[model samples]
Target: MPKRYIVEVDGVPPSPSPISNAVVVGNQCWISGQLSVGDDGAYVPGSAREEASRAFAHVFRIAEAAGFSRSDIVYVDLAFIDLADVKEVNGLFGELFPEGRRPARTVYQAAKLPFGGRIKVQAVAPR
Candidate 1:
């Protein structure tokens, strides 16, 4: 049997709890829930719109590190603490995928997230 390799990326944020930022198995890379952590690893305060953009950017970084691109994303799971931010996340989604190609997505309202994050996004990309 071929050895299936698993990859992990951590230290993306100061999660009050333990979690993996991403995990790669075989030819697929699974990114964990991404919040609004910037390249400097700081969470900026703003509307969910701005936060989602930053979160997506952070997600792409993890994808890149896993040797994948945004175009190769196959699925995404999103969470929001409030439904009112749906429009904001949708608008940011438009800006992120202006080419009209987006991965299969599922978004839901959650009661809470690690580190008090308002939104989190998980992604799966071909590796």
Candidate 2:
């Protein structure tokens, strides 16, 4: 059995809730839901693409903090206020993850998100 450790990235705002940003056991890391919020915990206002990019940035940063490579990310769980933004968010995802090296993703139309964000993302990595 491997020891589990919580991961925290510097410059990322700490969550006001009790949730751990991420947890790692052995080679795998499960990053909690991340939003497009700045270090001040304020939502970064922008289009869905921009917001998704920031969300993805937060996920990758947390993954990196756990010693996982960006390309090594194995899964992602995305939540969106609108399903219409999937294509746009996918465009940004493709740009970041690339085609040949993409993670398995599940997208959902969320009723509402924390911080009133239009988008949120959670990730699992190191497959």
Backbone clash total, candidate 2? 0
Could you give candidate 2's per-residue lDDT for residues 13-82 as a string of tens digits? 7888898889998878999999999989888888999898888888888888888879988899999999
Model 2 weakest lDDT span, ten residues long: 11-20
lDDT of 2 at 56: 84
Q: What is the lDDT of residue 8 in candidate 1?
A: 51
Best by TM-score: 2
Model 2 residue 70 lDDT score: 90
Q: Candidate 2's error at 3, in angstroms?
A: 1.4
Model 2: colliding residue pairs: none
Q: What is the lDDT of candidate 1?
A: 0.76
71-95 per-residue lDDT for model 1 (tens digits): 8888888899898999878888876
Per-model root-mean-square deviation over C-alphas: 2.6, 1.1
lDDT of 2: 0.88
TM-score: model 1 vs. ground truth = 0.82
TM-score against native, each model: 0.82, 0.95
